[model samples]
Target chain A: MSILVIAEHDNKELNPATLKTLTAAQAMGDDIHVLVAGEGCAAVADQVAKAAGVAKVLCADHAAYGHQLAENISALVVSLAKDYSHVVAPATTTGKNFMPRVAVLLDVAQVSDIISVESADTFRRPIYAGNAIATVKSDESIKVITVRATAFDAVAAEGGSASVDALDAVFESDKVRYVAEQVAASERPDLSSARVVISGGRGMQNGENFALLEKVADKLGAAIGASRAAVDAGFVPNDMQVGQTGKIVAPELYIAVGISGAIQHLAGMKDSKVIVAINKDEEAPIFQVADYGLVADLFDALPELENALS
Target chain B: MKILVAVKRVIDYNVKVRVKADQSDVDLSNVKMALNPFCEIAVEEAVRLKEKGTAEEVVVVSIGPKACQEQIRTALALGADRGIHIETDTMPDSLAVAKLLHKVVDEEQPQLVILGKQAIDSDNNQTGQMLSALTDMPQGTFASEVQVDGDKVNVTREVDGGLQTIELTLPAIVTTDLRLNEPRYASLPNIMKAKRKPLDVKTPESLGVELGSKVSVLKVEAPAERSAGVKVADIAELVDKLKNEAKVL
Candidate 1:
């Protein structure tokens, strides 16, 4: 069976999640084709052609797709969905925005975020805020699925020589207009893809205290994350939240500082290979799941940890 | 302008969800239930619009078994003008739910529709987008801020990296994010007043929408437990354990 993966990328570079999605798609089928739909995205098409396990890359470069509007992207995917047995995309905000539209147009129930591909139709996903795992099977002609990138390892970025083809399709809608975007600038790695992630919580007290995390993150070459409590308390922006309702990360090492591990917070980072918790409250639930538990005040621990790392 | 806000009754956010031993689904027997958090934000946003005089009426809708009416009443207590309970025995898939909402949208013709970005139970962030597709309307999902002008609405969305502001024409769909606004608690007197609010109960057949699920759950089980490991007395030992034992450093 042939599969079509909607590549997540800007015109400049492909999202690392796309590589993980490609790996998930490869597990489901051999004949996998990548669709790079964006304005002036030929570079992304060229990059996907070399990604391992891809058979072909279809580049649909158009001004209408530059912003990845849901109305336009859904129409584009629906138009070409007739040729594939399965359609997949990474479960990023962009993919979540458009994939459901594709499902409704196709009159099928789209699988939200599958973590494992049991087969072409059956897959495993988390539900109830990652407290439960549900194995689901789809009975539709074309299975529409979103892959949780953290659950799958990324495929090799190179070693394939798939042919790149231009796809002439444009669907523009006048109902929506892009105004502006304020992307958070960070010198550290992206949290979702970083190997090491250090997060703060309510115990960080205020936003200014995040500098302590920044110092430690700089030493570890890691990404900075925060719990929902910290974000809700305005200690950090919403983008930094790692929880059931926020971004999910499964890094090689996750250090949760002064965070009372709520279940929602645990849902996001419990998959990390190594978990370390530092909290003043000895009774904090975070210590229950932590691989290394250190009960201490973050203010004192932060300085000590920074010096130790140095 | 009239606004439509969709809400869902999910297990209370504070409750620890447990998987059933039979593996059929999550065990919700005698568990506390409340309005889904994101949907509460949607309701709050709509109520705020009405309070700001941008919206004349705010109508809330919920689809589920009769038990979901509790959530509808909760929304009414929070200042929704009316409530619509689409009664059904089984939980339909996201697409089916969207189609039902589409039928309501056709009947009500509200100028704007707001819903939660995702339900806490299924965590399927699809219904609002699917409803937007079925109605051929624009959507602003994961909205942190929403401002309604004469014929347009500016939605600041919380995306992957940061925030994006998109303008959609009237009659658009919006799904709320966490930072949209802090939802307020309903007062006791307001709760009593909500009991008198007009709540219409309708069936899927009444809307002429056939509801069925295309996906079936093969099994449901608890996530693999991560047992606690060694405790470190100090920062030095913690760093040593990471570099030597776990080797993640």
Candidate 2:
């Protein structure tokens, strides 16, 4: 049976998470279809058509889909769900918002944030904030799942010659209205997808000290992250938080400066290929997980590390 | 206007979860349990709405075994007007929970329904969205800020990049995020008074909702632990180890 991969994009561009989701879809089966629902997203549809392993691209263009409203998008996905054996979406904020609705309307269960595909019906996921991993099996005929993009390697984006087909389904919701958005713009790569990530914690003391991490991040061309304590202390915004409840990242190289490594914070980044912990406290829990531990005062180490990089 | 808030009792966040030797599930034999933190935030938001005169009454509900009534009473002590306990032996999946809540929403007919974005134990951020689907109501999830006007509510959501504000019509659902508000502790006087508040109990069979689960757990296991590594003497040695040994530089 064919699988449907819901493309995650923002009208003009496709999110890299969708590529990772496609990788999971490929593991389930070979026949895969990509659905791009947005306003004036013909370009995104064309991009999906070129993605490797995509058999076809279904484009739903309408003003209502521009924001990817759950009420409207779920209805549309439900409309097309019967023809496919499986429906998969990236576990982004957008996917988490709407995928459950799709599961319920289809009278099935959604396997949220599956890190591995043990089988078509069985999968592995984190529970209790990643403390334990559970393998779950679904008996429903149509399997609905949300993929943790960081766990899967993304497929090639430009290799296939799949056909792009337009879908004329309109679901305009009157119960909700879009107001405004405030997205943090940065020159650094996205925190989740970046190869190298540098993070701080409460030991950074205040918001101003985050600048020191930024200087190091600039030198390494890495994304900046923070612990929940740092965010709670108002040293940074909530979006920069890295923990069990926040965004999860599994980068190639992860550097923790002044972070004591609470269990929740460790759950988010412990999967990194290589980890470096720099803290003044010798008994910090982060040192237990670090491949290379450096006991140092970050105030003295940041400038020296940046200079050495040059 | 009346507001409905849902709470859950789960293993305390401070507790380190351990998988059973048989791989059935996480061991919960004698661990301390508390109100789910995000649900506490939802209860706080509802109580605050009533305190601000935007809501006339705040009703708190919980679904689980009889022990969950303790959480409901805690919500009442925190300033909820009444409490409802939907008793069951095992925890239901998110869909079944949503179905049960849909029946409660039908009975209460509140103008607003508030719940935590996700439970700390299951960590499946699904019930609120599922309930919204069943009730056909607009949903504002991961809400950091909620402001109820005359006929509409504006919710500021914590999205991936930053924040996004959306306005929903009356009779909507808002899920509380971490930054929603700091939940308050129950005062001594309120704790004594809450014992006298109205409390009701019902079952899923009485509500005409089936408790059958479509998903089954195969096994539960601990994640692979990372072995401790070497500690460098200085920054230069750390750089050399990264470039030469780890090759991650």
Give candidate 1's TM-score: 0.99
**lDDT score for residue A89 of model 2:** 98
For residue A85, model 2's alpha carbon misses the true position, in angstroms, by: 1.3
**Model 1: per-residue lDDT, tens digit, A132-190?**
99999999999999999999999999999999999888999999999999999988899
Backbone clashes per model, in order? 0, 0
Across B77-146, the per-residue lDDT of candidate 1 in tens digits comes to 9999999999999888898899999999999999999999999999989999999999998999999999
Q: What's the distance in Å from true for residue B85, model 2?
A: 0.6
Model 2 has fnat of 0.85
DockQ of each: 0.90, 0.89
lDDT of 2 by residue, A73-143 (tens): 99999999998888999999999999999999998878899999888888899999999999999888888
> Candidate 2: what lDDT?
0.94
Model 1, position B202: C-alpha lDDT score: 99
B39 in model 2: Cα distance from truth in Å?
0.3
